[model samples]
Target: MPQMIFVNLPVTDLDRSTAFYEAVGATKNPRFSDDTASGMVITDAIHVMLLTHDKWRQFTDRQIPDAKISAQVMLCLSHDSRESVDQVVARAGTAGGRIDPNPVQDYGFMYGRSYADPDGHIWEVMWMDAAAAEAGPEAFAAEAAAT
Candidate 1:
């Protein structure tokens, strides 16, 4: 079986958070969801578990940081192309997410943008040229300089 990742996040409003994730291209996996939590599937290997504050406490005793004011972590998702990165960020904005909470990154061979969900969890969407990435930065720079 392939490895998979599930990112659990505390949400102020489960319904709103679920809707926001859906708008950003994640589908709800009802099989792993309940009133206190929703399993949002971003891809076959990537899942986001949106948990209510009460539900989140069950997993840990630590206090939940207000993501809007204090960031605990920033998640990132990679896209096939720069356009796809932009599209996801736009959809996030339309779904009431704060667009570009982090400054945009645009290297010739790579690009990235970020958005903060309604609950203020930041998600960065990025894209990189496969060949250039595989070649490493130094090699890519050498090639670019020659061209």
Candidate 2:
């Protein structure tokens, strides 16, 4: 079986968090979800587990980080196109998220932008073309000039 990554996040309100993820295009997996927690499917191998504060504590002895004021982890995902990255962030904002000051720009072959969810969880949306990335920033500029 292929290894998978499960990103566990502590949420003050499970319902609100579930709704936010749904709005951002993740589907809830009923088989692994319940009133206390929900598994949001980002991809076949990647998932975000949104657990209530109490439920989260049951999984660890340490205190949950105050995502609103602290940085525990920054979750990032890549898109197939630049417009898709913008769409995700835009949807997040419409769902009560806030956009970070930075904008997406061509950095060699990577283009991405960051945002904060309603609960202040940081998420970076990016679009990277492998061919463009392999060409490097200098090559990209030269190709653009030639075009």
Candidate 3:
């Protein structure tokens, strides 16, 4: 079996966070969900666990940073096409998330956009041409020099 990954995040409101992720195409997995936690399945390999602040504290004593004030980490996702990236951003906005503060980037070989969820967790989505990405540094350098 392949390795699976789960990103656990602390949320102020369990229901709200669950709803936001559901809007982004995640499905709730009841096997791992409860009153204080919800499992949002993004894909077969990737899942996100939304844990209430109270439940999160039981695991660690580290302070949970305020999502509105400071960024602890940024999550990134990949899409098959540029249009898919745009779609994700739009869905996020309609779900009460904020639009990407930065302009979309298109480098011919790669494209990307970023948006923040209602809880202020930034999510970046990108699409890359497999051929160009496989070309590695040379391709990036050429694109950079041309811009």
Q: What is the lDDT of residue 88 in candidate 3?
A: 89
> Residue 39, candidate 2: how far off, in angstroms?
0.8
Sorted on TM-score, best first, the list reads 1, 3, 2
Query: Which should have the higher TM-score, number 1 or number 3?
Result: 1
* Ranking of all predicted structures according to lDDT, beginning with the best and ending with the worst: 1, 3, 2
Model 3 weakest 10-residue run by lDDT: 101-110
Across 13-36, the per-residue lDDT of candidate 2 in tens digits comes to 888899999999999999999989
Error of 3 at 32 (Å): 0.7
Best lDDT among the predictions, by candidate number: 1
**TM-score for each prediction?**
0.96, 0.88, 0.91
lDDT agreement of model 2 with the native = 0.86
- Per-residue C-alpha lDDT of model 3 across residues 1-147, encoded as one tens digit per residue: 999999989988889889999998999999999999999999999999999989999999999988777898988899999999999899988988888855778877889998877677888999998888999857787877998
For residues 28-132, what per-residue lDDT tens digits would candidate 1 score against the true structure?
Answer: 999999999999999999999999999999999999999999999999999999999999999999999999999999878889999999999999999999988
Choose 2 or 3, whichever is better by lDDT. Answer: 3
Residue 97 lDDT in model 2? 84
